[model samples]
Target: MRRRTYLAGGASVLAGIAVSGLVSRPPSNERLLEAAREPSGTGEGSSNTETILSGTDHETSLYELDAPNDGPTAMVFGGVHGDERNGIEAAREISDWHPDAGTLVVVPETNRVAVENDDRRGVDGNLNRQFPADRGPQSELAAGIWDAVESYQPDVVLDLHRSLGIYGLHQEFVGQAIFHSPDAHGERLADRLNEDAVPWYLPFHRFTPGESTLSGPLLFQHAARELGASAYIFETTEFLLDHSTMVEMSRLAAAHVLELHGLLELGGDA
Candidate 1:
């Protein structure tokens, strides 16, 4: 495979301003659409699908997009919690994304049973909590998902979710936040979403970055700890925002993370 440079010019510019406290103007909607439609590398890439947890009721399709050139791999999971419709839609859209020089692995609905039943936890319990720290996955569905993740060995892992309220405002909710591993660019991802995707009127909908807790048995935490991947859990608020906006925010978050990890390269400057 052809090894391509990790960070493109636009991506590097965004990273620079994200750290220096200088804000870059948001890209226009047209530009964002164009970027989304364009292929990342020299030519169109190939794609394939596989079934995880085969022969089981929880089985779901895993979509992979491979670039013509070699770059870091990114894995995105959605619908871990069935009620988070925005994340599931966003992941379905991201499944069609063409990388500039990397591999993109997307599991749009990890817990198929939960998604089908429209419940938070599948029959086996909360799939997110099944991957205990320093231990094997606690459920068969979790094990199957983990097996797929291990086989891919993604360099970056993004799990999409939604909550009923904002993180700071609601005691039990963690929405509009990015929980990330130390090595990941969670702050940058937050900045990007706040600048581009969020509207000026919705000041309360801004995103913030928080360090992922080691005590949690979450899938992202497990990936960060065991695979040494730059893992992130992106949460949006389903209360304030409409369903369309929620999906857009989720899509933007995923795209920005992919760009940060060199799995994508949007055209134009930051």
Candidate 2:
């Protein structure tokens, strides 16, 4: 498969700014705790369930953890690129998790074929590029993932991945950062994640539609615009954080987002 060129220019500028640290410095531990201290939400509480979503040639698992309180639904997926080990680990961990409130849907592996093969592109093509299908038919795997996303009608969606290089440091990489759609909800969450402690923290980076046009149809953007769900793409740097650290950071990021959305109670106060 050929590399996409749409994001070439915009990514350069974003990287430059991020490397310069002009945006904001990493927050201190106390500051992080203070900034993180927001009112938590309450939940009705329920058990966890797992469902296997199957398509023509691919099958992935979906875990649903329902809270006693009827709240928003959150969808988190990983392994769309197969080789992104960090996201896959995080997604799998989230699958077994029980949220404090609201509904949590975890798709640990979006591209089962690609993941099994440890390849970026599946047998059909890049699963990430096949989303929100415009003209041609969607790959079987992409279609299956889309069906699950649509059926759940999530209030927010988080797509996790691991980038090859660190953002700002590597011109071609978008790692160690949060790539968000135009939706304000997702953007706000990205901002919050930006303030996290070092190593696990990520800077907020917004890619304009024109910049990402050739990157393929983005499911996150589609979910935000079409389904009215706050969506984001969380990319961790494989260079800076080890696989385990990356997974831990991904979990922290997801928990923060859930808290911000009031989907889960942050502390016992709620």
Choose the strongest candidate by TM-score.
Answer: 1
* Estimated TM-score for each candidate: 0.87, 0.73
Clashes of each: 1, 5
TM-score of 1: 0.87
Local distance difference test, per candidate? Answer: 0.82, 0.64
Name the runs in model 1 displaced over 4 angstroms: 1-33
Global fold similarity of model 2 (TM-score): 0.73
lDDT per residue for candidate 1 within 1-270, as digits (tens), equals: 111122233235443333332123255544554455578538888899999999998889999999877999999999999888989999999898887878999999999989988899999888999988868999999999999999999999999999876788666788899999999998888887888876665576789899876567999999998999999999988654667778878887887887778776665543
Model 2 poorest 10 in a row by lDDT: 205-214
**Candidate 1 backbone collisions, by pair:** 41-100
> At residue 93, what lDDT does model 1 achieve?
92
Give me the candidate number with maximum lDDT: 1
lDDT of 2 by residue, 142-249 (tens): 666777888899998888887766666567887766766554355555455454524222333321111122234777766765677877788876553446656655
